[model samples]
Each structure stands twice: as C-alpha cells, then as structure tokens.
Target: MGKNVNFTLLTMLYLFIYIVASPNSTIDKNALLAFKAQITSNPNKILAKNWSQETPFCNWIWIGITCGKRHQRVRGLNLANMGLGGIIAKEIDGLSFLRSLIISENSFYGFFPDEMGNLSQLQEIEM
Candidate 1:
C-alpha cells in the first residue's frame, strides 16, 4: 500500500514538470498567422487547410514552419517553390526564435522588412 502511494506521487510530479516545462507559443502563432494572411495567391493551396486558428501551429501541415528545441517557437520557415505571391509582412520579425528563413523560387515582391533585423537568432536566409 505504501508503494502504491509513492508511485502515485511520482506520477503527479512528472505531470507537473511536463506542464511547467512546455513553453507558451502565443506570439509565434500570431506572427505566422499574420504572415499567412498576407499571402495573395497559393496555387497549391498549401496554407489553406493546414494553417488555421482551429489547429495548433505545430500540428499544421505547412512544410515551411519548424518548431524549436526547447520551446515550440517558430524556428524555421521555408516557403520555397510554393508558388506563393505577395508582399512579405513584417510580422515575421515576431518569430524571436527563428533561425532560418527560406522563401526562394516565389513571386514575393517589395523591399525586405527592416524588422527582420530584429531576428537576433537568425543564422541563414535564402531568398
């Protein structure tokens, strides 16, 4: 009987740790959604069904978005060859954990957003 009580306590501890360790990714989700909204055309309809408020960003079917190691923050965005066209939104700068940005082979126009410089963790950007 004592052993059973000890096991229950351990299990509860584990659950508490898991919940506390998980990072809230509200800002990252909002930023990505903002960028998705700016997309004027999507021939493949990639972001149509996948990127939605009803779904979790991590579970979205977008091939470009990537979550980070510790937290589930936006770590990478690769939109290459997606046939997407429109001006890039500055909201991307809100991805504080972003390390990579790939938007090659698309029809994105206009000057790059100056806010991109705020991405201190950005290591590579393929345009």
Candidate 2:
C-alpha cells in the first residue's frame, strides 16, 4: 500500500513538472504578440484590444488562434479578412508546433518569410 501511494505521488509530481515546464508555453504568446506588432491597421480592432500582454494568449478572444490540447502550443492561426496590413515577420517561425495558417483576404504586403519553412508541423497554409 505504501509503495502504491509513493508511485501515485511520484506520477502526480511528474505531471505537475511537465505542465509547468512545457516548452511551447510562452513561445506561442511571444509569436502572436510579434505578429500583432506588425499589423499597422486593424479596422475591426479585434487583435488590438484582445491580444494584450495583460492576458494569456490562449485566453485572447482573437478569432483564429488555436491552442494544442496537451501543451497549449499554438496549433493554427487564421487571421482572415480583418482588414490588417503589414509585413509578415520571420518571428512567426517560433510557433514550431503550428499546423495551419490562413491569412487570406488581408492586405499583408511583403515577401513571405523564409523562416516559415521551419514549421515542420505545418500541414496547411492559405495566404
């Protein structure tokens, strides 16, 4: 009985550590903020007001930022038709676990960043 209790405690401790030390915890937040910074105009002001530093990016009310189930890593970003205009920065590559990207109907002018090739998990992108 004592051994079983010790094993349960150890398992719980490991889970706690894994949750606290998740690698993608803050990377998505930073990447989203960087992306937001590039937007010069937001006619709808969706990202401008919600994607603030005061709240976690996961909790932000932005339309298309999806978080992973286990680790809260960024999984998808679809910033379509928000009337945004800006350069897509290379810093976006920091979202290593990102699976989808859809920035259609927006007016982001500039060559797409080469760093986007680093997103190995990216399965779809419509820009």
Candidate 3:
C-alpha cells in the first residue's frame, strides 16, 4: 500500500512539472498576443477583438483560426469577408503549419509571396 501511495504521489508531481514547463502554456500566450497586435494594425477588423491573449484561443472555440489535431499549430486562417486591405506580410510565412488561407471578399492588393508555397500543410489558398 505504501508503494502504491508513493507512485501516485510521484505521478502527481510529474504532472505538475509538465503543466508548468510545457511551451504551450506560455508560447501560445505570447504568440496570440503578437497575432492580435498584427490584426489591430491592419486596416480592417479581420481578426475579431475577442482573441486576445487574455482569452484562451481553444482550437475548437477560436474564431477564424484553426489548429492541427495534434501539434495545435496555427493551421488555418479564414479572413474572408472582413474587408481587410493590404499585402499579407512576409512574416506570415512564419506560420509554417498553416494549411488553409482564405482571403476572399476583401481588398488586399499586393504581390503574393512566392514563399507561400513553402507552407507544406497548405491545401487551400483562396484569394
């Protein structure tokens, strides 16, 4: 019985460590904030205001954002019908996990980046 109790205690401690040390716990917070800043600087309200770092962007609940089933990286960005007008930043290519990009019904006038094809997960690219 004592051995079992010790195992349980060790398991709990390991879980606590994992929770506190995981990158997802903090990386997402900072990344989401940067994304919010980018959207705010954009001309249109393509990104809704509710997606700040203070708000946990759960994959199932996030608006205009989608994550991979496993890695949960930013996999899709749906900015259609939002009237956003500008070139997609070259920095956006940094979202390497991106798969779907929808920018229809808006006015973004700029040359499409050739690097966009580098997104290996990309399946749909709607302009």
Candidate 4:
C-alpha cells in the first residue's frame, strides 16, 4: 500500500510538471486566428484559405509568417501589401516571441491594439 501511494504521488508530480512546463503552440495559433478574424477583406484569399486549424501555424511561412527555429513560436510577420484591410486584434500580444512585424501599405483601420506592448521580444514594427 505504501509503495502504491508513493508511486501515485510521483506520477501526479510528473504530470503536473509536464502540464506547467510544456510550450503551448495553440496560444500563437489562436492569436493569429484572432487577427484573421478581424480582417474585413482579404482580396487574394491568402489568409482565408491558408490560416486554418487544419495546418499548423508554423507551417504558414509562405503566407508571411516566420517561426523560431528552436521552438514553434512566431518570430516575424510580414503582411505587407496583400491588400488586407481590418483592425488589428488585441490578441496579437499573445505572440510572446514575435520579433518583427510588417503590415505596411495596407488599409487597416482603427487604433492599434495596446496589448501589442506586451510583446517584449518585439524589435521592429512597420505599420
């Protein structure tokens, strides 16, 4: 009985650690989806056709997304001149590892989300 109790406790500890330490790619994916949700117009259907849960967000490099080599985190986003128009989503800040963002030459309206300031790793932004 004592051995079983100890084993159960140890198993529970490991599961807790795994849940706490594991990186969640969903956060970045959801953030991107939130941004997509705000897009009023995507003339080329680039995002509409590509940005879906069926494909991993890290695999979206062709559509102006860049992911970190070491992890699945988004590092850069270049949505320039794709004829996209919409408000920027406040959830954009969920991309904690984002380093560069370029959305220039587009028709995006509304104030930029204040939540973007939460991106500590952000180094460059062009709007």
* The best candidate in terms of lDDT: 4
TM-score of every model versus the real structure: 0.80, 0.83, 0.63, 0.80
- Candidate 3, residues 1-127, lDDT tens digits: the string is 9999999999999897778645653554455454455443345443655566555554456577777666556778887887666566555655677778897887777677676766787889899
CA-lDDT, candidates in order: 0.83, 0.84, 0.66, 0.88
Per-residue accuracy of model 4 over 37-125 as CA lDDT, tens digit each: 99999999999988887787786544889998766689999999999999999999989999999999999999978998899999998
User: Against the correct fold, how does model 3 do in TM-score?
Assistant: 0.63
Model 1 per-residue lDDT at 53: 70
Candidate 3 collision pairs: none
A best-first ranking of the candidates according to their TM-score comes to 2, 4, 1, 3
Candidate 1 vs candidate 2: the lDDT winner is 2
Candidate 2 collision pairs: none
Q: How many clashing residue pairs appear in each of the predictions shown?
A: 0, 0, 0, 0
RMSD of 3: 4.3
Candidate 2 per-residue lDDT, tens place, 1-127, comes to 9999999999999998777855566777788889899998789898887787767666436568888767677888988888888988788999998999999998999897999989999999888
Superposing every Cα of model 4 onto the true structure, what RMSD results?
A: 4.8
Q: What are the RMSDs of all candidates, in order? A: 3.0, 2.7, 4.3, 4.8
Worst lDDT run of 10 residues, candidate 1, spans: 17-26
Q: How many clashes show up in model 2?
A: 0
Candidate 1: lDDT of 125?
83
